[model samples]
Target: MTPMIDVVFLLIIFFLVSSHLSRRENRMPVSLADSATGISETSPADDVFTLTMDAQARLFLNGSQLSTDVFSSRLPRDSTQTVRIRVDRSLAYEHLNRVLATLTDRGFQNVSIVTSPIAVSRP
Candidate 1:
């Protein structure tokens, strides 16, 4: 009985360590767009469009506040141009969806959400 218990504990320890190592190695950076793999080869445009949503649900474009209507109007007519959205993780899904809908209505198809590689620490 004692030997069996010891063997079980050893197996548990081995599995725990192996699982941790495998998980760490398998970690892939989370990206909002599927084409992120080739993003580096493409040069960012001088006129890159960006929209940011703060935790308080306030929106900003390149550090300037613009009404949703105004921002929507500023989206490029070219479908190939990318629109980047930087959103705080804590922002509500409903608010995010509303912003996405606004962009879709404006015909900005190639949109990307910007996120830090690792989650930020809460204050």
Candidate 2:
């Protein structure tokens, strides 16, 4: 009984640490573009691969900086894997397009451009 209880406590601690790390990885600083029509739905964390492009057009995969070539090489060829791109609003469209093209060429079909909900204004 003692051993079983100890194992259960260890497992609980492991899960808590891992979940916190995963959440931190996705919280990279990137000012997302605003979209009025964008839905607020998000896929399960395990099923989604997150990419971020900052204002300087620096690319990051799961909060780790990497070059475009490296990023391309790391992408899974599975078209069914969901990809979420969080790009800074100030970044140029060309940069975003390049990333999109890479994903398309890699056959990623379920890509999403993550954006912030537009703030409603009252006059």
Candidate 3:
């Protein structure tokens, strides 16, 4: 009985350590684009991927910075996967265009752009 209890305890410790080491990726802060029609919305579906670009034109996926090529490599090769681009308004159109083009060329066709609702104040 003592040996069995020791084995179980070791197994539990091993699992706890491995779980911490293998945690899922984290998401970084991204300021969404402003939209007159957009309001508070539900979270994105699990199948949908989000790509973000900050004011400095840095690209991120789930919080980690990566190049466009590296980003594409991480995605599924098929066209069925959907992605959302949360680009900073301060970024240039050319930068956004390049991102769009790259995703399209890589066969990710069903992509959406995420935006926040513009707060309208009455004078």
Q: What is the TM-score of each predicted model, taking all chains together? A: 0.56, 0.87, 0.65
What's the lDDT for residue 117 in model 2?
88
Q: Taking the tens digit of each residue's C-alpha lDDT, what string does model 1 give over 8-113?
A: 9999999898777534421322233233133331534444566777776767764666676686777778866777676777778788898899878767777877
Point out where model 3 deviates above 4 Å. Answer: 1-27, 38-44, 119-123
Per-residue lDDT tens digits of candidate 2, residues 19-117? 997786567888887887867656678788888899999998867899988999999767799998889999999999999999998888888988888
Query: Residue pairs in steric clash, candidate 3?
Result: none
Candidate 2 worst ten-residue window by lDDT = 36-45
| Model 2 pairs whose backbones collide | none
Q: After superposition, how far is residue 122 of candidate 1 from its true place, in Å?
A: 26
Model 1: lDDT to the true structure: 0.65
Positional deviation of residue 87's Cα in model 3 after best superposition, in angstroms: 0.9
Could you tell which candidate, 1 or 3, scores higher by TM-score?
3
Per residue, candidate 3 scores C-alpha lDDT tens digits across 21-113 of 433222456566688774343544566677788888778876788887787687766677777788877788888888888888877777878
The regions of model 2 sitting more than 4 angstroms off are 119-123
TM-score of 1: 0.56
